[model samples]
Target: MTPHNELRLLPWSGPDGKPCYLSTDTTGGPLSRLADHAESAQLAASTELLEHAREVLVDETSDPEELRLLATDLTCALRDALRVAASRGHRLPETHASGHGGDAGPSLPAAAFG
Candidate 1:
């Protein structure tokens, strides 16, 4: 993990204006390492879930309800990953009008996820 001083969590708005998370660490510390691990896990899980969803979507014999459930699960996992990334101060590029950028000041609240 990067040093606490080097970590910067940029906030992005969520459904309820919740902060989006990202992190940038030049020196990998324990915390940064942990965050990296968490990120990798989330990424892998997301990929797996998405692939499952796709397979379900393409499987003509698959139950529609199961496909829906898988999609929902994928969405939830993605949201959780985003939250975790935000909590770690990972940088997230602004994609919407209300996104944090430019003169919007700090992207995330200093107290976010603390």
Candidate 2:
């Protein structure tokens, strides 16, 4: 199943003053969705790398260097995806007391992600 389907994500304001989400599941109460998104993308990229690695392993004359290159490519992709995703959200405290709260309170912007 798609990773998005397996979790519940709530809109949230990120460090960039943009809208993002906090994800949750049946088990974990609430977690950062950006992290989840990054992880999912990383997994997909890693899976693709594994496929390429397998192809290299199958070729009798394939050099071990090819596998190393594939690993490096996978690592780069994963890192970039994670960086992008993690930057999309900001962490805020779970609650705010009245009187101290103001118009500047953290909130998820409507179009931040899009």
TM-score of each: 0.50, 0.35
**Which residues of candidate 2, in runs, are more than 4 Å off?**
1-31, 71-114
The per-residue C-alpha lDDT of model 1 at residue 87 equals: 59
lDDT tens digits by residue: candidate 1, 8-84? 44323448876534444453656556656766787788888877877888889998788778878987888867766
Off by over 4 Å in 1: 1-27, 84-114
TM-score of candidate 1 versus the correct structure, residues matched by position: 0.50
Highest lDDT, which number? 1
- TM-score for candidate 2: 0.35
The candidate that wins on TM-score is: 1
